[model samples]
Target: MAQPTYALIRFQEVGAAKVQTGLLVGDRVLALGEDINTLIRHWDTTEGQLDALAASVDGLTGLAVSDVEVLAPVEPVQVLQAGANYRKHVIDLAAAHRGPGEDEAEVRAKTAAMMDARAGEGTPYFFIGLPTAIASATDDLVLPAYSNSHDWELELAAVIGKEAFRVSPEEALEHVFGYTMVNDITTREYVFRKDMPEIGTDWYRAKNAPGFLPTGPLLLPAKFFGNPQDVQVTLKLNGKAMQDESTHDMIFGVAKLVSEASQIIPLRPGDLVLTGSPAGNGAHWGRLLKDGDVMEGTITGLGTQLIHCKDEEPTESGQQ
Candidate 1:
């Protein structure tokens, strides 16, 4: 197998402001050699051109990776997230919230049966996230002071390369450009609506806080990242392992997610489809995020990300 091609956005200091969007290759970083937005606007055609430039050193003097700050590789136009897509995770939650006097084994059996039925007949559930909530891999996460149930959910994100509309699962993989990692942080208390019981889940406020979604230390091209279905997602909090599972546990895999998302809305290049997180969330461990906590997430072949957690400072208005 050939070496994987990885791309990143490096920041350079000039005067008082920092210049963003420098391309990174190995230890060296260089200018886009073309308009950054234009390159992504025509990603399918321009990626090859960018790759060619990265391969040559002629006339270009690049900077070292250690000297430059790194940022998120893509600024997505839209972010679509899958929910309740991991079998083990669903089963765990069901068992945790079992009815009074209910047997644990019985609950597991029933949950497994329901999951099987959904896999065979039901469609995958998806929700929208804001691009403004996205942060860089090494950025600090701000835990809202109002909610004490802040949680971590490490997920594998698929980067879209081509426009897709009502595409079939059989042909959906072709629309994928690459894979990256995202830590989908959430405030568990805001997930439900207490005032209106029938209003259903409120994912918007629960998952879209500023710096909630930290993405991409590197973007590994799809052709080089190998099988997305088999990648391992491992997360450690403060040097102790918390989430350790593989993408194989996903009830709905990448192709099914892409196909389902396209059926709802046309997916454009630079858009992201984040497959749901596996079991081992903070709720299960009974250990929510606290100030000064650190989270490290790693996906096989894709790089690792370190995020420092802190409380959101109180404003003069006293609102969180």
Candidate 2:
């Protein structure tokens, strides 16, 4: 059975200038306040207050979810993303970029050993993401005309509820307020910096395009999620399933990720920590995204995100 947890969301009435911080209860939304961020910033008190209001919120509601336009749940001050953190995802990439004569069996064996070693001793590869790139999950996204290899990387992000630094893995999860889904869109060709080989991967250019990180409609409270490791991440392209995997395949679990991240910087309330993506990406299947493609992503318990892709609209300069 699912836990009794309230979803945190932002919504606005048709043509209304104000976006209300809302608690999602069934098909309707109950207005909580004007700023979701403010509520998150004081989640210690907000959590208790929400508990007190749960029974009443369930019975009393303002607007039907269909009557309002849902916005991305929160604007985090920081977006820390993990790369190559999924087991099968890493194996798939290794096989795709393998040297001549590298077979799947051989690649998988080598990858298994390597990943095991990484789990025992290595730290996760973390990167920064531009908050400006985040958009509502259901919005139409324009494929940046700069690259032909736009790919999908569906992820589950941990939303921080408290200020934490240098915390232990055992204590890490205590800082997490909830979880939300995000699709980390990548321009594959730009991943490698040709001009500077030493630079290796240029994540900033390859992954931070506008609307690249399509975020939430619901923020599932941590208590409700219980164990995120069992949560499944799945993405479908044009109604055809492409990526479907679970957090069980994650190299470093959410606790390790959040704890390690805190060692580097202070994770504040409303910040997002993306725990990487699962397998079955475009590179693995040799099918990249193009204009007119649509992606629908869903995670266990979390809601779904529908996105439409189109070519970047021509500007006065005819390019972006």
Error of 1 at 146 (Å): 1.4
Error of 2 at 120 (Å): 1.5
Task: For model 2, name the residue pairs that clash.
Answer: none
Question: lDDT per prediction?
Answer: 0.86, 0.89
CA error at residue 11 for candidate 1, angstroms: 3.6
lDDT of 2: 0.89
Which number leads on TM-score? Answer: 2
**Residue ranges of candidate 1 with Cα displaced over 4 Å:** 1-4, 10-19, 34-37, 57-61, 317-320
Q: Per-residue lDDT of 1-320 in model 2, one digit per residue for the tens? A: 33356788988899999978888877768888748778887876778777666646544467788989998998899999999999988988887778988787899889989999999899999999999999998999889888799999999999998898999999999999899999999999899999999979999999899999999879988888879899889999999999999899999999999999999999998999999989988888899999899999999988999999998877898666
* C-alpha positional error of residue 178 in candidate 1 after TM-score superposition, expressed in Å: 1.2
lDDT (Cα, 0-100) at 231 in candidate 2? 88
Candidate 2 lands at a TM-score of: 0.96
Residue 108, candidate 2: C-alpha displacement in angstroms: 1.3
lDDT per residue for candidate 1 within 29-93, as digits (tens), equals 77665433445557778777767767674334577777777777777899999999999999999
